[model samples]
Target chain A: MGLSIPVGMAEVKASKTADDSLSALGLGSCIGVCVYDPRARVAGLAHVMLPDSAVIRATDRVVEGKFADTAVPALVQRVESLGARRADLRAAIAGGAQVFSFATSSPALAIGSRNAEAVVAALKTAGIPLLAQDCGGTVGRTVTLDVASGLVRVRVVGGEPVDLYRLG
Target chain B: MRDAGRPGATGSLSGDAGTGTRGILFMAFEAEGITELQLDALREVGNIGAGHAATALADLLGEEIDITVPTAGLRRTEEIAASPEAAEAMVVGVLFIVEGDAGGVIVYVFSEADARFLSDRLMGLEPGTTQQIDEMGCSMLGEVGNILSGSFVTALAEFTHLDFGLSPPNVAVDTLATILSEITVTAEALGELSLELDTHFVQQSGQLEGRFYYLMDRDSLGAILGALGMAG
Candidate 1:
């Protein structure tokens, strides 16, 4: 099923076989932070909307998949549910735009930036090396993760699509 | 001094309090840290956000949705700090984290019933489920928050020729007090502004409640307005 998932959302759709994991489109200023472990053939994606869970109310259910701090852990846990290991898993990050009106603040500290930093921090804290990153800037991005092939695509307007796995 | 629009036939909740020439105009004092221009920028930015949100809603629900342009209203922390409704209000807060070029989050809140109304329609569920609240329901709710908030932030970038980084939206279901407290404590970090918009759904009772908090110093707002060629 070719489905388009909007921002601040994630879906774990699977195909009949181990080769049919799903993919989501466009992630900008929003992170398309994904995790995959070859051994488990498992992959997970989160379109995070904030940096940390601290900003949310304790009773909110949407908190799990909403922030980078929490969502990253949740994605890792999800992949692990299918038998993926943190040590063997490779991570990729993309998209975070300063989507609001102009300001003098450093874009590096904006929510998008914070999310990227938080994701990186969370992965490192979990002892996982971030294999690749496509973060920052002023554009919206669409990300696709083909769980079966372990192929990931990051697309943005005015630029060529990029392969997150192959990038140095 | 007040210029009230013709009051809608539907009586105000206060009934007796809204009959004057000025309808119901609740003006919170100008935000000490927020400037008029920033509020305007936020308003225009909201239009863009709402437009994108409308499109997403149309796509998700397979129906036509229209959102009226946003109007800016700067309310004091005290004014909005109070719960507007007596019943337990189901509010979803979408915080668009902006970094690199800008900083802040757009806090969009809606009544739980309204959220379910939009969620049911978006998920293609039948009517009468508008009052249902669950995790599945929250996912749909998160989508609307993400689209509307993200688009609104994106509009700011377009108008100011600035780039922004965004964090994912923080979705929650809570009471007005809880939601207000969540925003209140962050007062030091944000230049808050409120924009209450009127949104229309194809076959559902319309929804209301929208607000934005730009985490920037007061001066930055003037600069943004100057960029838009508007007065501070």
Candidate 2:
């Protein structure tokens, strides 16, 4: 079974009675960040939709999954609550594509580029080591992380296929 | 139920003015066979739902948003596909399943870019998160469409005095060809007389998109128009 959170939403690492665990589904300009603490046998997933939340005005609510500013903190808090130690966590990120077919533009500030950068910064700040990542292409992806087996399956519409274990 | 004596009238009390017309009216980005009044009613209904959706996004983003429903008229799917706007924009579509023997399908299409914006914001994560655009995206989009369609469904049930249930909305994200192809399939079974409307949501970038279509059989269209007193 899989737990699918909307973009900008976070789910802390947990192991339930159910043997199979997975986090599935994500969409445009959104990134799914997965963290696994092998020591704790816990895995967490955060689906981010934007670069930062502070940029959002005080009245809007639809961008919960789009920003790094909001997503990182929320994720940290969730995983921490699950009794996962900060020192042992490792991360893998996927999705974040410039899906539009427009002429080549600067990638420096594009939302996709920015989101990946922000996620990396957040990981560094938290002192988490980078484990793996498959990002920054035009195609969309559905990443399924299986906590029981530590397998991350990446699927795309039209792109080179990758085995689930490749990301781990 | 109102004025059952009217020879052409169906006994249902739901009154929709300016609704009936057997012929199809074509335009860019939308097509359907329901009465004009039904289309109008549907647009108003979309306004309400878009407001709710915008609110959901605004709340998550911590900002204020406004979603407006524009004036709509009948049009063809090809016309909508050919429109320059359709080429570069993200389209958000919601299909409505209404209750009653005469009830049929209703469709809503929006700009593709606007759809990306909506998805980016609605999911409340990163703007450029999912580049794959696969079934998961469809499910995410379906959730988005559900909100807008829910509003229309609520309005229809109340105004038509009929109990209509909405099947989970099937959401699709794609380019002009994808949008046109899907609409073509739906139109074949539903018939065509698409009435179009524009809906603008006020937010960070002031997202705007067009919404339209009301699908129904001949008698249903006439009854709705006659009820609304818009029949000419």
Candidate 3:
């Protein structure tokens, strides 16, 4: 049996051992970014809640893993610290769902799509290649990344687990 | 079979006096300085609203429904998400956005078993047998949410004398954590502290036990307090 580590809301975790798996559960509008280096058998996951931390004025206490812009870099650093090379890093993403659809005019309702865009942009800035992503639907998802095979699986309510991405 | 507890009996009110000077544009009010009296006032508002909602639900299901006194307070979005009561439970959430004078969101959460019970009861199907909610079941559940939410809003409006408009209810069946994460995301985006009101519901048949959470933004909270003569 593999060791399962849970990544809570606005949390990030990285593991280098092949028998370790990182999991983020109950992701609705929040996006989970997974980066893995197959060469080093290291995987990192961040559960990001918002698109941009810069837009928030609560500078006194900022959670880096909670925003797309800061979460991507922070996740990269975590993986790198575990002996994973940035040059060998590839990423896959999940979540970013609109669980409720009412009041389309409200800026908050569009946050799912905005978070996805922000994550893509941040990954580009970090020079990481995007391998695959499953996002933008009405259902919430729980995601797990297996460090042994670099396979990311997403599970939804009343649905079978689907293999969303694999890092080569 | 879980014993239900009254809301206000579980937690106490604590105030933070240092949040007065943050002065961020959208971060107007922090969860600080809320007095016990103010909490009691909010609790009264929730009690009245829950009474009305329970009455509506009882009428719809043709059963005796009981509701506990509501607990109201200021809490961080993360705290609500991390609560053990909601962590892994499978629930059906009915979410609505309230606009106008006091804007916020209201979420009615029912456990999967309870949701199916309500839907099955409404559809005249035998209880404890139907496992899945089809399209018709979904529509029935949505209507239940509409009635309960409308009644709750009406009672609050009457008590506070504040004009309020509600968007149509959006229903989603998922884990409680997922539903809560959506609320947390919206709350963080607005840079607003959440005014969390929680209520517990029970039915005579004992087939359903549900929880409802009402979250309001800072502006809306201020408006409500101002209307009740509790604003600083």
Candidate 4:
């Protein structure tokens, strides 16, 4: 049986062993990035909460996994350290949902969409192939990346689990 | 001005006393510095707000409602996400930002069952018959959330004399973790620290129960304290 490692809010985890799974649960507006290298059987997941770390004041403690701009790079580096080459990395993302819609113009209200855009942009800048994504909806999702198969599965509340994307 | 030692004057001069008590409340987190006085003050705020909300709900439903005393505390953004109360439970949430002098997010949480029950009541249908909330149901739930949260905000505004502008309520149905994640996003944007005030609601017959969370940013909390004449 493979061990399942749970990633909490604003957290990132990567696994090299084929017998492990990285999971991020209860993703609302936050985006979960899953990166995998099929040949090396290495996988990484980041629960990103915000779009840009630059908006954060210097006095505020920066959590690398908490923002899309920072988390994508951090995930790439972590996977690379586990022997997965950046050139071989493929990415799949889930979440980034506007769970609640408000009329206000607060940037925070639209953070989910902003996080999604940031993740995609970061992946492109890193030269990682964007394989599949299940994002931008009104529902919540939980994503799991199976290292052995590189299958990214997404489960929505009150809905059946679906294989959102995969990397060969 | 009356002397501080005078019996009637002490009540009027209790602002300093309240500040001293709040200081202990903050210190209590470090050690067991929370005093009965602090708890009482917090409970009083809860009682007043919850009382008003209960009245609003009862008026809307034409039924009697009851509320438990509220509990308030300071928690990290991650801690609230990992809390057992937010683990995998299906819930309906109404979230909004409190702008103006105090900035924060107010969230109203209802279990799937409770949401269904409340929706049925709002539609004047027989209770426990509806399994899901349709569009109309969602609208009703949103309005209820608005009224409940609005009542609480009004009570706090009157008590603290602070101008609090509230954004329109946005309602969503999802797992507790998912709903909490949204709140955590707001907390992350504001600050790592969140002031969490939680309360429970029960209908007169005890058939329905709901949980409400009021999340305030650290700056908002300081403003509230300042308005209350309590040291930040």
Candidate 5:
């Protein structure tokens, strides 16, 4: 088995360590942002929990990857610092499922949808193309990005791991 | 039934407080950092709330129900970000919105097997018959969750003499980490951390069935603390 690094909530993992696979597990409403530079074979993964960081940033703790707005930009920079070209970066995302889908009035049910929207908008602002995505449903998902092969995979509970995206 | 005293039954919950955890740090949107005394107050809250809930459930079923001593987890957002709770563990839960003087979220969680067991028991079906919780199964879970969570809130209100309201419960089945992470961010908005007051329910044969996670926002924390005269 290859080295699989688990990306926890509000954390980003990126480097030229191409053999390592970065994974975000049990993503409920939280989103897993994966950015890859096929040319450099370098990839970065971020697990963002919230839509934006404007309010979180004003707090006593500033987690760069806690929100989509911050995590996207931060992932881009971290991947680039690993010798990946900014222009060649391609992004793919997964997670952000409305697991608590019943109550339409509750704001908790909206976070998943809001996070997906914020991540797409952030990628657009950063001039990164969101080549693929699997988001927004009633089930939780686990996303993994294999840096060496640049293949992204997603798995739901009681299900097999399926290829979300394959980048040769 | 370990009749360990309330608050003292929690061995490691507040044991870490007097350690180096005390610093200039504070929960977001709240004025004070968590201290040993404040944690004791929160534990007592869990104790009283769970105590009342246990009695209510026992009365409803007309049977014996035992509650494990309540335990509290004051997890830092950073620690949660490092390694979430019960990674890959799935749970059937009902999320409730806390309203009135103190507001936050409370999640009533149970294992899939436990939920299935309870659902079977509720519907008077034979054990080991439920493959998956269908509409009826889910409804049973919801109603029971509603009753259990409602009892807890009533206890809090009575203890603190504050008015409280509960929203209609939203039931879900998902990974524990995912559910907890979502609650962490959603319940408090940008909260640096929220306390989780966990208590388990034991019924016939002393088997554990369900547990409750009591999460509070900054204001909720302050309100309870203030009511207890532990506000700092």
Candidate 6:
């Protein structure tokens, strides 16, 4: 019932305002990592596009939230910066769909499952507990995180938003 | 390669008109890094490439088809996903991986309604009869997109004298933002700057329409521009 600040690709956003909601729309082969601190009422979301930043290290375009290895840690840090304790943060993720079900050697086409795995591995490396995840399918999704209640939701195209997980 | 990631360099030439062809006012390609002269050369390439593509599409549909003036630019994954038309729109995308002289990805996008309509007609069924897309429909659409991509490839090959090999077409129906994100991100992750050249294919009856998107890597861009004598 409040403001919906949409998280964008390769971008990480955190909000301390209880009424604010964060969402990443139409995520295909891109993972939306949602981290929340229930006690502090802070929430953050990162729309990650690739598994590793090392692949694009040669380019100056390797932004923070563009890859799983970077996004998970960055999202945690952003929430911590917003009065949330690192240990208090918990995570839930959605998206990372194999949008095109094709047999190709390109890493991009098969990136969805790898993204899910990478995000999970990154969260583990950061010591953040992954409470729930809905990832890796043939359809794209929209992931939303409600800051006030720490509720996360997922919606496919032309479908209603359904509650996936709640952190508290 | 030098101009690939320079922000604020795009939208200089297109302005509010946005590539100036569709008349729909969607910012299909707010290009980056290329000079006006080089962009003109790229436009020439699109014109010839899409001309052949349109003919193939027309033949496939058994109807007259018109091709819009193509738009050329350098696009990042984030920018492509944030566009107004792509935000939440559902689309059918057919992808072809390009190899050989230049390597990258080319995708043809159609709105869900357009996909259904065209696929139904292609399958010799009533246009409105199909409620959901099936494997048969996807295969039909894939072949159609493959033929059109082949035509465009032939034109590009002739223009640059470069050999191109295409992988089998892969298809998906999803939100435009997601599909586009997957593509541009792939190029970025591979450390290639994505050069986008896109055009609209419109049938006279307006019953079928689609967008053809060609995203080449930095190597391809340089090679094609050099071949055309437009490289700086």
Instruction: Indicate which candidate wins on lDDT.
Output: 6
Fnat values, one per model, are 0.00, 0.00, 0.73, 0.81, 0.59, 0.64
Off by over 4 Å in 4: A105-107, B1-47, B58-64, B69-71, B82-86, B190-193
Candidate 2 lDDT by residue in tens digits, A63-84 = 3334566666666666677776
Task: Please list all clashing residue pairs in model 3, or write none if there are none.
Answer: none
Per-residue accuracy of model 5 over A25-108 as CA lDDT, tens digit each: 878888999999999999899998888777653545677888899898899889988998889999899988888765646554
Error of 5 at A112 (Å): 0.9
In angstroms and one decimal each, the interface RMSD of every candidate reads: 13.0, 15.2, 1.8, 1.5, 2.7, 1.8
Best by DockQ: 3
Q: Looking at candidate 1, what TM-score does chain B attain?
A: 0.63
Ranking by DockQ: 3, 4, 6, 5, 1, 2
Model 4 reproduces a share of the real contacts of: 0.81
Give lDDT tens digits, candidate 6, residues B1-232: 1122122232222211112222211223455667867766665566567767777787777777766533556766566654755568878889888887877787888888888888778878876987777778788889988999898888889988888988898888878877777767656655566677766777778877788877787778888889888887
lDDT tens digits, residue span B1-232, model 2: 1222221222221122112201111112233345444445544433333344445444544565444333233443323332433433445555554445335455556565555665676677587664555566556656655665565555555554555555556455544433433343333223332333334444544554445444454445454555455443
For every model in order, the TM-score on chain A comes to 0.80, 0.78, 0.96, 0.96, 0.94, 0.95
Report the Cα lDDT for residue B106, model 6: 79
Candidate 1 residues B1-232, lDDT tens each? 1222222212111221112111122222244554544544555443444455555555655544444322234433333343324313445544555554445455666666667667666777786566766777766666676675566556667767766676565555554444443443233234332333333223223443344344443344555566677644
Error of model 4, residue A91, in angstroms: 1.3
Q: Each prediction's Cα RMSD?
A: 16.0, 18.5, 7.6, 6.8, 6.2, 5.3
DockQ-based CAPRI category assigned to the predicted complex of candidate 5: medium
TM-score of each predicted structure versus truth: 0.44, 0.44, 0.84, 0.84, 0.87, 0.88
**Cα lDDT, model 5, residue A86:** 86
**For candidate 3, lDDT tens digit of each residue in B1-232?**
0112133343311111011111000111235677655655666566566667777787787666766434456766655564645566777778777777887777788888987898777778787767986666666777888898898889889989999888887777778888878766765666565587766777766787777767787778788888899986
Runs off by more than 4 Å, candidate 5: A104-108, B1-32, B69-71, B78-86, B190-193, B204-206
Q: Candidates' DockQ values?
A: 0.02, 0.01, 0.62, 0.60, 0.53, 0.56
> How high is the CA lDDT of each candidate model?
0.52, 0.50, 0.76, 0.75, 0.74, 0.78
